[model samples]
Target: MTPGPAGTTVPAAPDAPALLRGSGLRVTDQRVAVLEVLRGAPHADADDVVRAVRERLGRVSVQAVYDVLAALGRARLVRRIEPAGSPARFELRVGDNHHHLVCRACGEVRDVDCAVGAAPCLVPGASGGPVDGFVVDEAEVIYWGTCAACAATPALLATAPDA
Candidate 1:
């Protein structure tokens, strides 16, 4: 299903008691509210998250949002990413070895599956002096480009003779 505009009301936050019991979270109004915000606005920055949560739970403090984000990120429930020149953002997609494509002009992010279907892209150029045995869990690859929206802009196209 498509997401709504910022601050748009979605379903009420998931059942607090059941969610907490399943995930082992403490189950507070703030935590549920924070998760709901992330669910609606994946890759939202801290400030945006605060705004969204406040819209749902009126009077939610910025500090409360920060704390909840920290807790969720630590538990691997949320994925936190900070692309260069952009504020850190949080999303609910986790566990999969997904890469990202960040729009250089707009800083928008979208997930991409493993380069060839599974783990490890190209083998590391050099294994930092070969340790005894280090297992590689996941590999992250980011593709930077001008998104369709940015590429379609006349000003941007005019600047690039190649395009």
Candidate 2:
């Protein structure tokens, strides 16, 4: 187990190469490094992944990191979430019907398990005038508000203007 944030001990990350192979992807240094970065830092943007991968494997290209992310996403090894007014972030946690809590003040994101019921938590009622005939496989829920830290600091509670 490795020490996670806030003195919590979390299981060590799975082997990156093994994960790539299991996902039917060719194992490469760049791929491994990208996976490692996501494991360490969840909700990282593509630019964040590129910087971390380059730090580990010197001289890596931005396109290469993007390609690795695309491959991982296709294999369902990683999930991408796009918060409004924020860059798309990637996380290694996939498959589960989880949601996210996004902080409007700091843009901090944390996982929130399925809210009330089973997979695809909220279902469209028969009153589905707009969603008629639409099959809902998954529901993307993002609760936007100030995080605890930001709430404690009133100065940080002000929402920034959308860019």
Candidate 3:
């Protein structure tokens, strides 16, 4: 079954075939379910993904979700981001150097554009070492603050009066 407009689905067993072909990955139920979960959740941890997948497929194991997450991460079809004090969360938003704004209090996440104009955050300073034919890959930059909704709420404001 194809992803519904909102991205979640209770797909048929064979529906994974197209997703696998589109992503250049070998089609498998686990992978498709994992991808679908990530697509729907956008920033779900392994446990959360397992919950979503189980709701659709039933009786999937945690180890199985981890394995599928690793495989899909390797395929570059999904991105893994781990904010400090939070479990790693997966998203289908890949191939871009977009940064994340995380709410310190509630652990909410939102995407933001890069700070320093482009992909790599900073230019190597003269003191910066290790230029021995090594090309820098992707850079993950996380900005920590209160989310908009949290900031507006009275309870959050009471907790962090300075904010």
Per TM-score, the best of the predicted structures is 2
Judging by lDDT against the true structure, name the best candidate. Answer: 2
Q: What does candidate 3 score in Cα RMSD to the true structure?
A: 5.9
Global lDDT of each model?
Answer: 0.73, 0.83, 0.74
- Candidate 1: which pairs clash? none
Candidate 3 lDDT by residue in tens digits, 1-163 = 4443223332333344565787688887878888777766777888899999999898988998998888878877778999988899998777667678888767887766567766666446464444675556667889888877887787886775335
Q: How many backbone overlaps does candidate 2 show?
A: 0
lDDT of 3: 0.74
Provide the TM-score for each candidate, comma-separated. 0.77, 0.86, 0.78
Off by over 4 Å in 2: 1-12, 127-131
- Model 3 weakest 10-residue run by lDDT: 4-13
Looking at model 1, report the run of 10 residues with the lowest lDDT sum.
1-10
lDDT of 2 by residue, 1-163 (tens): 5664544334466799999989889999999999999998989999999999888989988998988899999999989999988999999877666788888888998877788888778777766333767778788999887778988886676554421
TM-score of 1: 0.77
- TM-score of candidate 2 relative to the true fold: 0.86
Candidate 1: deviation at residue 12, Å?
17
User: Where does candidate 2 clash, by residue pair?
Assistant: none
